[model samples]
Target chain A: MLNYLARRLVLALITCAAISVLTFVIIRLPPGDFVDAYIANLASNGSMVSAEQAVAMRHEYGLDRPVVVQYALWMGRVVRGDFGVSMMWRRPVTEVIGDRLWLTMAISVSALFLTWTIALPIGIYSAVRQYSIGDYIATLLGFMGLAIPNFLLALILMYAGFRYLGLSVGGLFSSDYAQEAWSLAKFWDLMKHIPLPACVLALAGTAQLIRIMRANLLDELRKPYVVSARAKGLSELHVVLKYPVRAALNPFASSIAYLFPYLVSGSIIVSLVLGLPTVGPLLLQALVAQDMFLAGTIVLLLGIMTVIGTLISDLLLMWIEPRIRLRGRA
Target chain B: MVEQVMTNPGAIESGGHMLSVRDLAVEFGQDRGSVRALDGISLDLRAGRVLGVVGESGCGKSVTARAILGILDRPGRLVGGRVLLDPGTSAEQNLAALDPNGAALRAVRGGRIGLIFQEPMTALSVHYTVGNQIIEAIRAHKTLSKAAARAATVELLREVGIPRPELRIDAYPFQLSGGLRQRVGIAMALACAPDILIADEPTTALDVTTQAQILALLRRLQRDKGIALMLITHDMGVIAQMADDVAVMYLGRIVEFAPVRRLFAAPRHPYTRALLRSVPDIRAVPRARLATIGGTVPHPGARPTGCAFHPRCQEMIAGRCETTAPSPVPAGLEGASCFHAESVVQEAVV
Candidate 1:
């Protein structure tokens, strides 16, 4: 097991290296850099810089250097815990991302928690009582959840919250608490604001997970081991939960590999519509402004999260299933 | 319905029968209409005796076992029947009448009665170790501590002839060979020490050598424990070797039932006679044609009007066999559901 884990860790490091290289290259793929966007903004305001001044600005920002040299310099600084400065915010990229990253993680984690807790039970119930009225109702609602886009759901929810509850249901904090430092009141306010966006974000994932869990459980319920479990005089609940449900959970475990990356990146449009102060909006701003340091760092972090998620998924699968564990040993 | 005479009157008179399935009928609902899968099937399983139920596929052999255990798959249900399980001390209870999902039936299953499956490969759960599964079965019906259950599981593994019980107990189902897996299945069935064991084609998925070993193990266990064994199979050789009493089924009904020796010695029903003849003789002339029944078993939806086997029987009375179903006739300790059972025997003798 140690050997297997060591091998996986090595593989993960290699994958993260590839992702960093790719993120760096992709961020540079656009025609112009942050300097070009800055110069264009100055010209639109009827204020222009001389060619010599523009060259001085590029040189100061290291944009005048070759791409390879710039990459090496940036990578060396990144290795030493420096993400450079965000050209858009004129601050350190780490400072720009710090609190927003936490808020993003907070919302995503809560959404994921809501998804599994709601989806698993409903999925198991739908499968065990297949074709029943409850099953039919769940199926209908699940399809609706999947069909409606996240941004649309966010819009509908925001309207509903404002109209009926008389509550301002946008962003991660109330206007008064938005700029406050850490406090119980601000944390409570943040908590109050989390559910709306979390629910919006979780709807599609929950619906898809329900469908996947239901289908997998349905297939497993017909297998002979289920009959064997039943024949052991186990109650219907015990039989379904112990045997088929475990077998059905395989897909759920492996899905963790995608869930992490999805939670970070998939919330982009939803974050935009809901006006949640998350890393998603910051990344979008960085990318649009061609702030290579900020955009590349965000992309690289997403990639690293994906690699870690895959590793966790593999370890979880090995824990749950003996077949995979033994195969890993061999 | 014709009044069918019950076979095995001697066992019934002696009050030795542990499980009795009487007038058991099952039906499956399809898109168009319902088809009767088991039609008034009756049999008796006595203590320390192996009752072999032999038939071709779709003859409702497996359905009979499932119905008796109250584990029939969906779209199929017990339309009418009484599965009387006598524990020899208390009043006998009709298992068929018990609510399928109720606690009473749950206690009866794997508690008072156990069932072994056909396919060993799929019968056990791959997620659990063999030891864990057996321990779960043991604890389900008994009030035992975890350590006690684990000890009992190890003992069961040893009882079923698995080598190095301590280590092999931790192995998953996929790690074991087919024979060893079936042994694990047997250990699971015998975990709670049930009064009756219903093996549904237990050896059908095994090779000949493994089949013999499993049969031997089953016989030894049955004898030592005095458990009533209901062995369902399609192999005549298995029936001959393992069964004390034989019940021959055709189209969801038992056509003939007798002691194993008597069934082979003086087979009465034409179906049973054909089944016996179809078994290849080791000393027969080389390069000779093998004997086979004339046609396949008919679909249950399109059952013939009279005797189900008449279409394939040589002695089928033209108008009589085609129009009227024959009630079972008692002959000594055996019985056959055929009008020309005696004639078939006489013709064979001639």
Candidate 2:
């Protein structure tokens, strides 16, 4: 097990290195650097920066160096917690990400927990009482949830809140609480506004989870081991939970790899529609404005999360299934 | 029913029968109609004895076992029956009359009567260790602590001939060979020291050598533990080797049942005689076609009007066999559901 852990750590490092190189290359693939975009913006605004000053700006950002050297230099700085300056925001990439990363992660984690809590019970119920009225109702609701786009749901909820409740419901906080210092009122306001965007985000995921979980469990419930467990005089509930449910959860557990990156970089359009500050819209803005350092950092962070998520999923798989753990040895 | 009660000499044994199935009937609801899978089946199982039920596939041998254990799946319901379990108690209780999911039946199942399935490969949950599954079975009836249960599990693994029981206790079912998995199944079934152990084709999925080993182990366990074992199989040779009493079934009915030696010595039913002849002898002429019972079994949905075997029976009486099913009658020390039992016995004597 220790050897397996060491091997996974090495593999994770390789993945991060590959991702860093890929992110550097892809962001730099487009023609012109941040200075070019800055100069073009200055010119479009009927202002001008002298040629020498532009060259100085290029030198300041190390755009004058070869792409490989620039990448190496950036990677070196990143190792010491320097993410270079965001060309558009004119601040450190970390400062630009500041509190937004925490908020986004918080929301994503809550949405994930919510989705699983709702999906697991509904999925188990639909499968155990298959073809019953409850199953049919859950199936209908799941299909409906899948059919509705999250951004549309956000827009609809926003309009309904304003129209019917006569409330401003776009941002994650009220105007008063937005600029207020951390206080009981601000915390309460944040709680009140969390449900809308979180629900909008969780809807599609919960639907898919229910369908996948139900299908996997249905397949497992038909297997002979389930019958064997039942023949042991276990109660119906105990049999379903202890035996088939563990096997049925394999697909859900493996989805952890995708889930980490998904939470860190949530639905950009939904975030835009709901007027919430999250990493997804920030990443989009950085890319549009040609802020290479911020864009590259965000993408690389997502990559790291993916690798960590996969490592976690593998560990969880081994923990849950003894068959996999004991497979290698004679 | 009266004739059955009168002819069953083993019913008068001192300890009484461990399990008695009288007029046990089971039916499956098909798209076409209800198909009777077990019809008026009666049998007696005694402690420390093995009852071998032998028949072709779809002859309801497995169904009978499932019926006794109350593990039959949906669409297959007990239409009529009485499973009288004595359990060497003050009063016998009718298992068939109890609700399958009620607490009373739950205590009886897996506690007093245990079942081992046919396919060992799929009989155990892959997610659990052999020890965990066995521990689960042990704790189902007994209130042992987890550590105590673990000790019992290792002991069971050791008892079943698995090496390094302490280390193997943590091994998953997939890690073990098919023989070991079946051994685990036996260990789980015998965990509660059930009064009756129903092994449904337990060795059918095993290789011949492993089959013998399992049979021998089962015989030893039955003798040592004094548990009534119901061995269900399609192999007649296995029945001869393992059974004290043998039941020969055809189309879901026990056509003949007797002491193993007596039944083999003077088989009365035409089907049983044909079945015994179909076994290839080591001394048979080298290149001859093995004798086969002609024709396939009738589809349950399209059963013959009277005797289910008449269409393929060479000794079938045209008028009598076509219009009426034969009731069980005494033939020497055995009971056979054949109208021509007297003639078959007389011919054998001649």
Candidate 3:
């Protein structure tokens, strides 16, 4: 097991390195650099800058160097925990991302929790009582959840909250708590605003998970082991939960690998629509403004999360299923 | 029904019948219509005796086992039946009449009767150690402490011929070979010390050598425990070796039920004779074509109007066999549901 863990860790490091290079190249792929966008912003604001000034700014930002040198230089600083500065925000990338990253994770984790708690029982029900009225209803609702876009759902929920409950459910905090320091009230206010965006983010994932879980469980319920378990005199509830449900949970556990990346990237449009202070919207803004450090850092973090998520899922699968654990030894 | 009761009068009179399935019928609902999977299947499993149910594939052998246990899969319902389970001490209870999901049936299942499934590879849960599964079965019926149950599980493993029971108790089902896994399955079925054991094609998935070994183990265990064993298989050799009585089923119905020796020596039904003839014999002429029963068992949905075996029977009576179903006729301790059981025997002699 230790050997397996060490091997996976090494692979994760190589994956992160690859992701860093990819993120840097993609960020630089646009026609212009941060200097160009900066100059354009200044010109649009009715200010003029000479070509020399623009060149000096490029040199100052070290953007005039070849892409390889820029990547190597950025990587060197990144290894030391310095993510350079966001050209747009005029702040260190870490500082710019610090609280936003936490908030993003907070929302994502809550959304994931919601997804599992709702999907698991519903999925099990849909499978065990397949073709029942409740199964039909769950299937219909799951399809609707999958079909509706996240941003559109966010808008609809926000409007419904405002119109029906007379509550503004757009952002992470109400006006009174937006600028307040951490306190019970601010936390409570944040909690109240989180559900709308979290639900919107979880809708698609929940729907997909329910379908996966139902299909997996349906396959398992007919397996001989399930019948054997039933013949063992286990209660119907015990038989279903212990045999088929546990087997069905394999896909659910493996799905955690994608959950990390999905939460980081999948919440982008919903975050933008809901105006949630998350890394997704920040990454989008950084990308649009040619803020390489900020965008690259966010993307690299997402890549790292994906690798770590995969490792966690692998470990979870091994723990749940002994067959995988034996294979891991090989 | 009177003839049915008369056919197994010796077993009922001897008070040795552990499970008596009476005219049990099961139907599977499909898109086209409901097909009768088990039509009036009747048999008696006597204590300290092995009753082998032999049939071709899809002939409802497994369905009979599942129906007796009241664990038939969905869309398959017990349309009519009575599974009278007499566990010696308690009053006889009709299992088929009980609610399938109720507590009464739950207690009887795995408590008064145990089932050994075919395909050891798929019968045991991969997530659990064999020991854990056996312990669960043991505790399901008995109020034993966890350690006690574990000890009992190891004992069962040892009894079923699993070597190094202490070490093997922790191994998952997937880690074991097919033979060892089936041993675990047998141990699990015997854990509750049920009076009746229903082994549905228990050795079908095993290799030839493993099949022999498993059958031997099952026979020894059944004898030692004096459990009424209903061994379902398609192998006539297995029936001859292990069974006290044999049931020959064709398309959901038992065409012949008799003592093993009599059935093999003077098989009354033409279907049973054909089945015995189809068994390859080593004494036959070298390089000769092997005997085979013509035609396959028809789909249950398209069953013939008369005896289910008539279409495939060489002794099928012309007009009578095609139009009218033949009910079972009692003859001492044996019976055959064929229109010309005597004629078939006389023709064989001629």
Best by DockQ: 3
Off by over 4 Å in 3: A44-46, B1-15, B30-32, B87-90, B329-333, B342-350
Candidate 2 vs candidate 3, lDDT winner: 3
Please write out the lDDT profile of model 3 over residues A1-330, one tens digit for every residue. Answer: 778889988998899899998988888899999888988888999999899999998998899998889999999999999999988989999999988878888899989899999998999999999999999999999999899887888889889989999988778999998888999999999888888888888788899889988999999999999899889898999999988899888877777888888666647888888988988888889999999899999888888889989989888887887887877852
Tens digit of per-residue lDDT, candidate 1, span B1-350: 00101232334235387887888999998546889999998888887788999988999999998999899988889989799887343668999999999999999899978999999889899999998899999999999999999999999999999999999989999999999999999999999988689999999999989999999999999877767899999899999999999999999999898999999998888899988888899998998888999988899989998888889989899999999999854422377889887556557679
Give the whole-model CA lDDT for all candidates, comma-separated.
0.88, 0.85, 0.87
TM-score of chain B of each: 0.92, 0.91, 0.91
Spell out the clash pairs found in candidate 1: none
Give model 1's share of reference contacts: 0.87
User: Model 2, chain A: how large is the TM-score?
Assistant: 0.95
- Candidates' chain A TM-scores: 0.97, 0.95, 0.96
Candidate 1 lDDT: 0.88
Instruction: Give lDDT tens digits, candidate 1, residues A106-134.
Output: 99999999999999999999998888899
Instruction: Rank by lDDT, highest first.
Output: 1, 3, 2
Q: i-RMS, every candidate?
A: 0.7, 1.2, 0.7
True contacts kept of each: 0.87, 0.62, 0.85
Q: In model 1 chain A, which range of ten residues has the least summed lDDT? A: A258-267
Docking class of 2: medium
Choose the strongest candidate by TM-score. Answer: 3
Which candidate wins on lDDT? Answer: 1
lDDT of 2 by residue, B1-350 (tens): 12323444344344347798888899998546899999878888886788999999999998898888777776789989789887345558898888877777778778888888888879898887788898998898789999999998888888888889899888888888989888989888878777688999999999989999999999888777667889998888998999999989887788998899988998888999999999988899999889999999998778897888999999989898989988764322467888888666668789
